[model samples]
Target chain A: MAEASSPGAPPAGASRGFGRLTIEVRRSVSPQLRIGALAGAIAIGLTISAIALVLAGVPASDLAQEFIVATLFDPTNLKAVFVQAAPLVLVGLSAAMAFRVRFWNLGIEGQMIFGGVGATAVSLAHAGPDSTRLVAMFVAAMLAGAAWAAIPAALKLLMNVNEIISTLLLNYVASDILLHLLYGVWKDQDGFPHSLKYSASELIPDILPGANGGLVIAAAAAALLVVVTARSRAGVYMRFVSASPSVAEALGVPVRPLVFSTVLLSGALAAVAGFVVASSQEGRLTQSFYQGYGVSGVLIGFLARNNPFAAAIVGVLMATLVIAGQNLQVFYGIPQSMVQLIQAVIVMCVAASDFLTVHRLHWAR
Target chain B: MSLPTKAVALAAASAVAWSSVALTASALADVFKIDGPPKVAIILFGPKNDGGWSQAFEEARPELEKIIGAKIPVVEKVPEDSSAITPPAERFIQRGYNVIIGTAFGYSDTFKKLSEEHPKVAFLDASGITNGPNLESFYGRTYESQYLCGMAAAAASKTGKLGFVAANPLPVVNWTINAYEMGAKAINPDATLTVVFTGAWNDPVKERAATTALIDQGADVIGQHVDTPTPQIVAQERGVYGTGHHRDLAEFAPKATQCSSVWTWAKFLGPTLESIKAGTWAPSPYGAFPGIKQGGTDIACCGSAVSEDNKKKILAARQDIIDGKNAIFVGPLADRDGKERIAAGATLSDADLWKMDWFIPGVISQK
Candidate 1:
């Protein structure tokens, strides 16, 4: 209310010179600092969240210490954080690949569900050598994921449909299909509600003896994605198209095929994440097996800016936060929902804080 | 371990004291001892006000606190994942909470790990499958109460078509469905129960939708195994009768809910906590499968809609359960598929009871 009418207006500036506020967007802002503002925003957000906890009668000292103990001080707890973050690595890559071409794929949930269904089907379909079964399951998951992703891509390419709505709504459809199978044909006669467990011969075992195999797969995938994005010609073409569609057109890039392929590839990566989760974490398909890992992966994509290496780091951090928040709620009486609220608040404030930090606010004299 | 062998003279008078049983010598041999006073905490699978399973646990807190002589801290909405379960359990142990009660089947594996990792802390989980030297998993024989609810429901229903919105078609859920049909048959031999499996425990939207579908299909009474009272609410809206689970759901559908299969957790937990305090808490070898007589569950019955004559019959049936004179799952019992499940004059074992996947004669579902 006590500010200048315009950021760069002399007439308004003159009228309210004695009592006015001025905010000017800086000519240039570094990307590094913009990212740094995310950290700053999160720090502020945590401080505010902690204050809220205090106001709600949660002992601040206990909550703080328990959080540190759960996330960092306890070595055993760290293993859990790592285990959870493994599948996110691939899902994050999925979203990152799509974001490279500005494809807002909200249908990763559907892709993951089909990916799980595909692998489950192959495992149940027949018996084979362990390696052969693993490879078959992997390929099937990717094919299903890609096929599911193609629906929205086709919608966008053929009819210029908005992908956000189409992709998001498909998640429910996928859920219904999973329920149908669980309640119908796949229903274990031995266990009416739960589907039959996939045989051990077909499961993807851990690479290291007695260790979670998903972590090894995630690491390899991260390395491969890094090379593909940094050195591959397809990556270069996608970047060029992102930089300027007209230039990409002039340079003979097949725009439709390139976009379609990117979307397919994006879904294939996410499907792998689903496979990892089903094999390593759940070990069997249940009604609630597919949690919101896809949505979380999308958020990781945003925070990591579609960078594989950064996604790995951020995903692990988020896993720790989730694990730590459990201790906070259980031990210190903090609300379990606080963890989700703080995450959303930090993400929201990051953009505003980035802009604010880049611009200068002054009082007109 | 203290009870008279003789059946109580007055059935209705013993209604509040439904199932007071004399503990066997094996149960009296309580082996474990707590390090100090009982500092209890509860880890709930859903929000405290979830209107069902979790709320029943929360509601028992006051009685539990009184029995244990300490305030109990509770953490709600803890997920079933290991990562989500471990930290809170450990935190409770770290904070000197020697007794931890969990409410979820999903917590089975995690509770087993924690029970071993922290030998000094006693861990208990409802509907969980795992146990150790210091851990005991407990679940109720819910069919007993559901049977009572069925009687009340049949009494209230003008039309005998009862519909059920079930969660998972698991054994625990299945038992209730079968026993309900049996009880309904006891009231009116032609009464048939139709079932719809929603496949989730706590999805209200699905529960309500299923309830509406059931009511639309000429079901005048609704039965449920899902974790919400949405079915009862829907029945109330449609002017039909319904039975509730977990708590006295008549609180939600005062006019519609005639009875509820309620968890009398405090009746089981209070004495068990006292045993823990007295340094004689022997965990069950095969988990605590407490029946009506041992205080795992009971029915909240006889709403305004239930007639006095029917209420008398319900009370008599309930007394038979308490006196161990009636065995619900005893044969000659054959499944709907005409397969003999139990031999004539024989009772089903606990293992077989937990695997009751088949329906009885009058229960109709999509199969």
Candidate 2:
């Protein structure tokens, strides 16, 4: 409560001066206020991004054409957006699920890497018939991701190792292992540092003429997540664990198994993201396919406030930004750093809005 | 806690809209032809001012524009992924671009596919392996220029121990390491070259650590095949001599850089575009490998550290390579392991060059 005091407020045990502003923690925040705060943050983020981009010499008309018409309306680019968004949706849901259990799953990229490797392994080994190869690859990817996620979860449970550090450091280990395979055994016939391209039958088939299978898979996953969170007994248990672990433990919730399982599910979902990314977008297990996704997952989780439904929306928005950013670069010759900066601004602004949800500023005497 | 039926509907709408996109990509051209006036564009694999590989193309754009007599716009930071490469490329094509230059090995497959999809557009990629009827991949024989830089490094070295930083143990990188050693040996017979591969192209932190480690190991000069000028920058800070790759490193580290293996894409690309405009272009099925003779690459030679006599020798060697009187990889060559890599009275083939995994004597590396 003392920490919530504003900068100009008097220190503890002193008389507060008139017109001195102070912040107080709210007992509960109304949903309407939460929505209003989010809307305000979005407005600020968009306005700032617009001003920055305009200052950088992008015309307002062109910006609209690029972001709205080109990214959202153009058939080819919209398809590309769908392809890009699929992995983002899965990773976003995964991050949200882990965050619900109060577990910071920074190892999203590592699990993704293992997932891609496992899928590629299935394809390379011809593990199943041509018709069933894609399914086999998907299964392998999920298992691999879960296995990778188990490491950090077990360490956190057994030795109380800080999951944040372990998960973050494991990203490098995953990349190195990926490189090791690419540069060694998995190198293509041309000696490039990428695995052989998957056979067409092993790749994600387009559900519609141009609609990739990955998007459907991602949408279904998001829907499944919504169901699991709202309808399942495990969902209620998870809410208890999220509110307060010790309290939940005293209330007879199986905290350890719940946390572990949630983390594993998160890993599996992230791995599915990798599978889609490789199969649908890259067409092969490439070194950099998993790049930038770990941060994107976390950003989506933050922006969506760990809600699966909101995550799907945020994923589409981010995918739109990516496509539009590419258009801006292609047309205006703006640097990628500027595009990334706009994304950072939006994320930072949205994240800052969290402060308003728990506290209110008031003038005190 | 609410159902996301609205999100599912949105996804379904987006998916339904996708069906409007036609999947009718076919290669119908027997000979590549532009339907309108030549319009050229470039797709860069990194930022325009990345201080290395991509910057070389950015620097070449104006010169290429002059040769083609039209503005050659560029899109930078297009990654090697198909999804990333496609949108910019398709947009350029839609806006009537007839010629597209790509700068990355990763752009190969996409370029090939795009070339087939749009036969009227001529495609070219640097360091790419793929080539087709409407597509050609070209790369400078960097080993030739690096050889000269190696001589310069050896000349500036007080310790007779030189270091090299590279991205990968791939043939392209390994060839540079070998050529650098060969060039160093030409000046100082016993000058040994130690190499460190950072496993990434543009990682400055790793490049800096590798450079510092080499300098600490008594290396007086450094050479690099990595994309960044970090090795040269580190050398300058450490008061050691270095040779640069991609672009002239003297721009970043004037004091310590003895010479730089610089890409002369303008010289190669200008003529290629001219031929392309004249409808006389015939892309090689095996891709183009230009050397100093054709100006694919050359050296920005002789910093203050290199003696005038050594500078003369380096220039003379460059001239010999240009005149086809000398080959960097020739007969009597043996690997560091004392295994014969080149037989007597023979020269290394281009195919062998691309598959080069063995290093010549006096070249040391972890690989």
Candidate 3:
């Protein structure tokens, strides 16, 4: 195991200002165990998934082929998976940011939906000869997403409300709003409960020939988050607050404001995911558009242990499973729901591995 | 031998023959009946109100119940995943449902396995390929109706180019596209058809995108095999003619969409259920020919967009099909590679039509 610091010298932060506290914190984790723990967890998770597939009646040969095909081989199928994963990656980062500070913002899905509705409303309202109206719609989507998230943030900061419950409950409210738009105001005049077709002027120009621009936005956000958390003073403060709220307060960190900002930022990022999905993927609001990306994002964040960069990778992997599962269905007649079972297994394995990494195991037998 | 002894022997032999016949008849009539009303279970892959395949099956449930005088229990929005299908089916079978209907193609394998395990339960699968002593598969001849829609499109088109937006390029989908092309060519020999596969069953955006691309490519008349109204909406927006599949969609684009191939599943379900009740349910692998004559596959009420002349032509084409004067997959056919599928002037057999997997001459595959 890698030592916490050189034996002859005091911990770097200890001499600088924090004293013994920095040394104690540095000594807790060994570098060698981190990689091993992650690998072991993943292996266990895959084994569980394989067993579930067997119980589900999928032949072992077919399951193996599905995993291989999902990881590689088919680009069109792979593209669909990436498209599915893109939203989750963004929302997962949002959850990770708040989670690092021990703040639970379960309302990421609601924020995303509101953002989508906001963008759709703006696009529909101002659709015409002017191109600038499209830009306005994008801005409106982001603002609405942030505003929707801010409500819970305000509630948590002022009234000391449990954000987890409030945010989770808001998901239904946001979904109801979406239904209202589809069924009432923006409903297609054809009598079907779908929104009217979005005009060409309403769509955002694709960043790549075939890719959605929103994917680029998500990537940029992930990169920015990594840099901020790794190099900025605010990140250190957030870590301090997360580790010990009392110590953070004694060190003069504005705990309440910091919490409020993190929650708000988290919501805004999640909202962007929703906005992109609505504006680019479906164009018009339909009840089936969300496809559970919000919940999947939370799962990915948990698997990544609240690391934004890691969440992105896990999100992509999750999406790959979906695409691969569908392909397997087409090729081997396997059910696509196998993807969900695989996801559950991976999450459990990762969680268990993390536990083992943190604690020493004893053999009783 | 004594006369009294001989008469006794004759009477005993007569009794044995009569009893044998009676036993065989009773064995043939053997049916598993439970106390109270007959329980029927319906499993669906999506919501009952999806306005698609599942919805169509759900609509027939009430009519079926009314016919049988029994309350039917439907399991709606069931996952297509095999893992979910088996457990739910086992539970339903344990509860003693006499009949189970699976309404999706993916459920065929699971239903087949379960049917074997519970031989007393009659299994009816829609859009699946399974047939056993207790399991039967049912599908309507949807391609025949799609051909009529094609005639309407060919007559209504101003550009002489027709478009088909398909969910996937499977053999089932190929039947509809081929029928449309054949019908269009019968009406207007110069007509050209273009088909695009969106690689999904229920993505509205992809469907719309494919429709728009087809319209931009100078396709003046459009038809779609998707489960949503997006195609009709797109056709209406582009001011072109359109046709629908699986259900009536004229209401979605009354101005641009004129007709649809509506499925009437109740036509077969009512008779099939009666047969089951009478203890005469036998596995019949023979496919049902649901043409206009049977009221199973119907051309929905045409919208005002269809002209009287076009309607007359469509009706004439339909009559020809009904009278067996026209065969959609009639041979003398050549695939795209110019290799003869059937020798020139040779008609295709029923087996040939059922297993068709190639594109005809003049059609381009986007693979």
From the highest lDDT down, the ranking of the candidates is 2, 1, 3
What lDDT score goes with residue B365 in model 3? 50
Question: By DockQ, who's the top model here?
Answer: 2
**lDDT of each prediction vs. the true structure?**
0.80, 0.88, 0.72
Q: Which ten residues in a row have the lowest lDDT in candidate 2 chain A?
A: A11-20
Q: Which of the numbered candidates is closest to the native, going by highest lDDT? A: 2
List iRMS (one decimal) for every candidate: 2.6, 1.6, 14.2
Ranking by TM-score: 2, 1, 3
- TM-score of every candidate's chain A: 0.85, 0.90, 0.83
- Candidate 1 recovers what fraction of true contacts? 0.40
Model 3 residue B13 distance off true place after TM-score fit, in angstroms: 34
- lDDT of prediction 3: 0.72
Per-residue lDDT tens digits for candidate 3, residues B236-300, read 99998899877788767878887888878787777778878776776565434455666567677
DockQ of each candidate relative to the true complex: 0.35, 0.54, 0.02
Q: Is the docking of candidate 2 incorrect, acceptable, medium or high quality?
A: medium
Ranking by DockQ: 2, 1, 3
